[model samples]
Target: MVQERLARRRYGSEVGQWSGWASWSACSRSCGGGVRTQTRLCLEKVAKDNGTDSGDQPPSRAETGRRRLRPIQCVGSDKRFHMCNEEDCPPEAGDFRAEQCASFNEKPYKDRLYRWRPHYSTKRPCSLTCGPENASFYVTLRRRVIDGTRCSPDGGTDRADHVCAAGHCKHIGCDGVVGSPRVRDACGVCGGDNSTCHLVSGIFTEPHLREGYQLVLQIPAGACSIRIEEVVPTRNYLALRAGNKEFIVNGAWNIDNSGQYQGAGATFMYRRQTDTQGETLAATGPITEPVDIFLLYRQMNRGIKYEYVIKRNASLSSVLPRLPNDLQSLPPAPPPALPALPQLPARPSVVPRPTGHRNAVPAPGVARPPHTAPRLPATPAGAGQRRGGVLA
Candidate 1:
């Protein structure tokens, strides 16, 4: 009975004996669901003369009548944690765990030096597991990774949604709160409805795609929540190029694994499903540079579906409106005007002759002489019969 009473006295009530929480510790990371901690001490007040303190004894004796605080193991937890630095890490910054693994570059483990890379362990998410390039064997460098390191190697790229804290994985919602139910809306605004942005969607079915790479779409800067998919299975593959004509994905006719790729100051998630025979591209972005999507056609193309969100009041370029799709729809210019023809001589007027008469008619203004009688020769009467009585 006495021992039980003494034990209860040494470890006081959780709230009553504990001190107020100290200021939170520095965040474990600069971005991506970092964690901050606060700690409280379990204390018990005792007369200075008792000498029953839990820590080191004082150099000098204290007054008999005075009291001092002594720390004890409390019945409750001594530390508490909350999420911090929930914003996304920049694309160029790379992955936090990957950086940790790379720190062991040229490290010796099995009688040889090697370049190290992060090897994810689903069973122990918080462990720092590393492997060499192009090698399947891996080793656990540390039992626990630094707080704020991503729990999974491929959780995401744009943000650190899940992270390790105090050797445990913790989920941070889109609202940046731990264990919250909030999520991003269609516009990718946390806890918001779909009213913030407008949807832009279209299908490309050009009926004929050339034998090589062809432009499928040009996603402008300042667009958000972009998605592109090949709706029907085909031998064609998708490609991406920056505004400077630099290829971002599937360049040089090489196939890339489904993963996150950085370009145009944004990160794109590429997914290829062989089982479904479809390929998809997605991003949560307000990209800072324009990117053009291309289709590499080895065979016939069925169709591609694409959609994105853009704010209102954006200017649609009247100039080169058909710039997308390789500008195949522009009208042909008209032929140059023909040179004027040279002048020709005028045709002469024609006059008709009276039927059965060989003589040409006189001009209309000439007047004929008064009527004249017929005359016959007298000596020539035996040659022909005279028609009139004048001469026979």
Candidate 2:
């Protein structure tokens, strides 16, 4: 069989070349199991189809049908994904998409200029331009026809209903504080644009008054959720829910010392970490869904002021409770004191076995008793001598 195979190879049955793999594409993200892709070509098939040895491109549709479908299994899939860059967030500062959303804009729409805030929530739609500051002058819709609806009066658009009848709706996130940045595409780009993220901050009160509200925050990434870093030093009581889990934070300095009127009631603030000497802790979440952070507006009226950070594709298991690398510095605690050993009863000294000398040696620090030999009775000797004389 080996010889036949060698003969076939000599006859050029086995081509000298096979397709090689392509270079890997860039990683999809900085962390959280982002992916990269690469591919290989079926060089033999490409050569047979194009009458060329080099495999540069795929076979055309016509060419594929012209040849028998099962001519050969020469082609491989064009792409594959591999997870990479799954590292924890650095302890130091980095990009803050949340902060970028806290911007303001005054965009012109027709005769009126709309005061535009950063869009945070995903529930809103984007607007079109209308510039006609001059008489008989006006702006027009970028999409004169959207979803089969006309952008103009004759086009019969559903702009009044906030629907994209005239064209496909545009979901944008830029300088918007109310839009959900979490509604991004696979590339993490917001609103089909390179728009950055906005920070979701608000004061949640008990009975949402005209000015009060229940704070709702979107996670930084769908796979990785939000990280709420406490900004203020004071205690604040809060009840928040993400997915099926619920969380509560009572701002009282101490649980035993807290009262209804004492400290952080329903409302608090998310200040910077440098504002207090105590460690400004954070509430981490791998929330797969949106998080509702609010209070029962009726229990308390004041709102809690807070800020947050974004976490994407995070390693929930590998991350320590504290900041990175801080766990290693913790000192090893001393072992508990051991109970004293019990005393033993006194016993006779154990004498060492006799050495080559006449006497045995005593244990160190032990004294020995005096040694003596047994004596015979003098009467026995006198009796024996008298008996002998009598016999004579």
Candidate 3:
């Protein structure tokens, strides 16, 4: 009983303790989600160096009662921040870039009155392109985008959309005409009757064209469609679009992949047959007008020899124009001119109230003379009677 009592008493006086965290702080923001915090000041308990009992001494003091401030071991970083400010904005108020561009000036840029272009990002090409009247080395170009106009990318003048790219044109044959110097299709070719044409098939390689890539082949009026095959190399691809329908021809296999596909014209299907080169595809029964052919290739002036031919008496006519897509999808107009500054309902002019001040000060040069009393009749020395202020 003595041993049990001593053991129970030894452990009775002390226990470890810690405090719970305080309540969380209010949310940082109202509309959008934000951050809050809850934290606790960690208090540490340690045995005193003086070997004093904590039960007898206060938590801060040891046996001597001197305050011992122990460096904190549990100093914690608990503060945090997060996203906020999600109030709904007006529909048209969000696009700051457009507003910046649309900002106006009464006078801007070289003293021009109404600048059609934007104050920034105005470097875009404007003009049509054409080929030389004759095959001279000369090339003419319209002026570049205005100087100091920001390039589209804003870094520098590279691959800029609004600025003029070096315009290119396909080589019009010696006989074929581009835009100017209109002459008859000399060989009476594409639009010509079959009298001048035969089953001519060979590598017809022409080096140049005018302005952009367009090749007009004269198919007879009755023939609806035709097929072109690649002879030498493989994987020469071309796309043909009529009305809204489009088809691709992998000329390597000489497949008229387009002739079988749905077109705006009548459907025609043909199979491939070896014709010493690769394969042959024939387009039948869709021709209503002369077929316009365009070859799709890059590094245009690199002068790669392309081996292909139009078989059915195709003649070199004029090259049609390849127009570029609009550079910027501009707003229909300039946001209605910012609503005309609201015409501010003019008010009648107001009469200003006079400042409170006395008017007693006489104007300069005016003066008041002293008033003299009416002459009083002399009165007898002792009588002292007065009527109208005369001395009695």
Candidate 3 accuracy as lDDT: 0.30
TM values, all candidates = 0.53, 0.21, 0.20
Q: What is the C-alpha lDDT of each candidate?
A: 0.64, 0.31, 0.30
Indicate the TM-score of model 1. Answer: 0.53
For lDDT, the strongest prediction is: 1
Which runs in model 1 stand beyond 4 Å of their true positions?
1-24, 27-124, 127-143, 156-160, 175-182, 252-257, 271-276, 311-392
Query: Model 1 over residues 24-65: C-alpha lDDT tens digits?
Result: 999988986678888898775443223344456553446322
Error of 3 at 154 (Å): 55
Model 2 ranges with Cα > 4 A deviation: 1-79, 82-199, 203-230, 235-239, 243-245, 248-304, 307-392
Rank list by TM-score: 1, 2, 3
